[model samples]
Target: MTEKEKMLSGEYYDPGDAELVALRLKARLLTETLNQTSVSDADKRVNIVKSLFGSTGRSIHIESSFNCDYGVNIHVGENFYANFGCVILDVAEVRIGDNCLIAPQVGIYTATHPLDPIKRNSGVEYGKPVTIGHNCWIGGHATINPGVTLGNNVVVASGAVVTKSFGDNVVIGGNPARVIKEIACSDC
Candidate 1:
């Protein structure tokens, strides 16, 4: 398989491959155009973002300094609002569901390197998909790690480093991110 195909399949692959580099360049150029725009040019910003992503809902808003690797692997649902400085390293798929609110400086990462030094030195890396269910709210500086699939209506506290997945309607926090409290979802 090709490096990109391997990467997408969660297998260790070379990131410096020509195809991957070109894809990353494309995403960078698009994100640069988006980041340079002023708030007054909302239409232009929206257009760029829409074109950059694999798919995006009609009602989507992202603040400045939004950057991603391989924008084609990122998909977001309707009424998604991402605050400033949101960085998504979408080496694999990164899917965010409807009505999600991502606070400033939140990083959603799908890329990960090998723990073994020999493998690491070989410059081989892999990726896993990240999925955030509907009505989720991620606080500022929070990081959603690779392979995590958060269920619906989840609330992530500020600065939390989420290493694992959780079911619906739970408020999670802390370094490794454990459920702090369960929210009552009368609507759900």
Candidate 2:
């Protein structure tokens, strides 16, 4: 199977090898294009992002300091907003649903090296998809690890590290984020 195919299947793939070089080159070019100050038109900017990513919906705003490993593996829904310094290491698929608000310094990473040093040195890395449901709010400096799914309307506090799935209407915080409270409409 192709290297990309391997990655998609959640298998270990060497991104450093020649087979994935083209993808890396494309990502670099797209990153440069996105960073260019010459592109004044919003449509043009959006087009550049769309070309890099697998899919993106309308009315989405990604900040200037955004970075991703493989843009084509990332998909985003409509009305999404990513603030400054957001990084998505999408070696595999990273899907974000509609109306999501991502604060500054938030990281959604899908790539992970093996635990064993020997295996890590071999350049074989595994990846898993990350899914963020609609209308969720991810706070600043939060790290969402691989294979995690955040349910709709979930709120994550700043500096939290999400190591597990979060259910809807919940407020989560801390290093390995855990539910602080279940949000009720009456409280609002």
In Å, residue 145's CA in model 1 sits off its true spot by 0.6
Name the 10 consecutive residues with the lowest summed lDDT in model 2. Answer: 33-42
Compared with the true structure, all predictions reach lDDT values of 0.96, 0.88
- In candidate 2, the residue pairs with backbone N, CA or C atoms under 3 Å apart (3 or more residues apart, or in different chains) clash, namely none
After the best TM-score superposition of candidate 1, give how far the Cα of residue 155 lies from its true spot, in angstroms.
0.3
Clashes of 2: 0
Enumerate clash totals for all models, in the order shown. 0, 0
- The stretch of ten residues in a row with the least summed lDDT in candidate 1 is 37-46
Q: Which stretches of candidate 2 lie over 4 Å from their true place?
A: 38-40, 186-188
Give the lDDT of residue 69 in candidate 2: 88
- Model 2 C-alpha lDDT per residue in residues 1-188, reported as the tens digit of each score: 88778888999987876757888788878877777735357787788888888998878777777788879899999998889889999988999999899999999999998999999999899998999988889999999999999998889999999999987889999988999999885533
RMSD of each: 0.6, 1.9
